[model samples]
Each structure stands twice: as structure tokens, then as C-alpha cells.
Target: EPVEVVVERALAAQAVGIDGVIASGQEAGPIRAATGAGFSIVCPGIRPGGPVGDDQKRTVGVAQAFADGADAIVVGRPIRLASDPQAAARAIQAEIAQALAAR
Candidate 1:
């Protein structure tokens, strides 16, 4: 979706008393600004330097998602399809920690 439309919808959702939104990381920043700091934004389609294929088009790294004002992120394929799920999860956790520390 176009970012302007996504932000518009997020603003509208907030206006009607919606508490949170699921947006792409790229759109989270504008949504945050429109909805204020306390509003929750859960971003999906997170990719950490892996092949994205064609399933998820609007994806970002964990660090970028947090940097773009994502309150939470939903990660799928990377951990799900990893040869070592535990290690994949740990790597993502480490990325999250580094991002938070940078903030």
C-alpha cells in the first residue's frame, strides 16, 4: 500500500478510538506522529538480510523497524524455516537488543 494511504488509515483508526495498528515498518514513523507516542504500532514483514521472495513486499530489518517507531514486530520465515530455530531467534533477539541500546 502507498504510505500516505496507510498513514491516513492509521490516523482514521486512531480517530475512531482504535488503540493500536499493524503497519509496515516504513509507515510506522508517520503513524506514530499522527497517533502520538503512546499509541502502539505492531509491524510485520520483518527480514534480517535474508531472501524475501515475493510473499512480503514491505519488509525491514529489526533495527530499522524499531528505528521507524515500531512498538512491536512480527517475524516469520527467518526463524520458522531456519536450520537452527533457536539460533535464529537468538540472533534476532541480539539485533533487537542492539537496536534498543542504540536508541
Candidate 2:
């Protein structure tokens, strides 16, 4: 099936009580629009910078993901490679705080 069609189906499934929907950065907004407001959208492969070491073609950061209506954003390597993992997490938390404040 096409990606859009898959998103629609995923949204429909959530409407009928599926646990949640996994959306890519590009798919997050569209899936959210397709589903009801209450549907949970979980986005993975979120990298802040434009070209990380990984092979993920589509990616967005925590703030952007939240801004795009994602219920949650996942960040992997950025945190792992940080000299201070706690500080990295704190920065992400700060980003979330700013996003929440903006909203």
C-alpha cells in the first residue's frame, strides 16, 4: 500500500483502539490529521541535525516533532554521542519546555 494509505489505515486502527501509531517525521502531521485528536502519535528516528551518521532519510528534533503534533519524539545517537549524556537530555528537556511554553 502507499504510505498515505498506510497512514490512513493506521489512523483508522487507532480509532478502533489500537495502542498507538508510529509515524515518521514526514508522516507525523499527516497521520495526526487523518486520525482523531486523541490518537497517540509516536515518532522515531528523530535527529536534530540534517545529516547524522545513521541512514535515516527523514528526521526531526524533539521541538519540531512536538510542533508538528507528534505525541512523542525519539532521539538516539545525539544523546549517545554527547560528552555529557545528562546534559544532552537536559538540553532536550529545555527544548521541550520551550515548545510547551510556545504552545
Which candidate number would show the highest TM-score if scored against the true structure?
Answer: 1
Clashes of 2: 0
TM for candidate 2 is 0.81
In order, what lDDT does every prediction score? Answer: 0.86, 0.75
Per-model TM-score versus the true fold:
0.91, 0.81
Q: Encode model 2's per-residue lDDT on 6-84: one tens digit a residue.
A: 6878867876889677777677777777775788888888776434656777777676777777888787877898999
- Model 1, 1-103: lDDT tens digits are 5988998988888889989999888888888878888789999889875336757778888988888788899988898999999999999999989888887
User: In model 1, what lDDT does residue 11 have?
Assistant: 85
lDDT of 1: 0.86
| Per-structure clash totals for the candidates | 0, 0
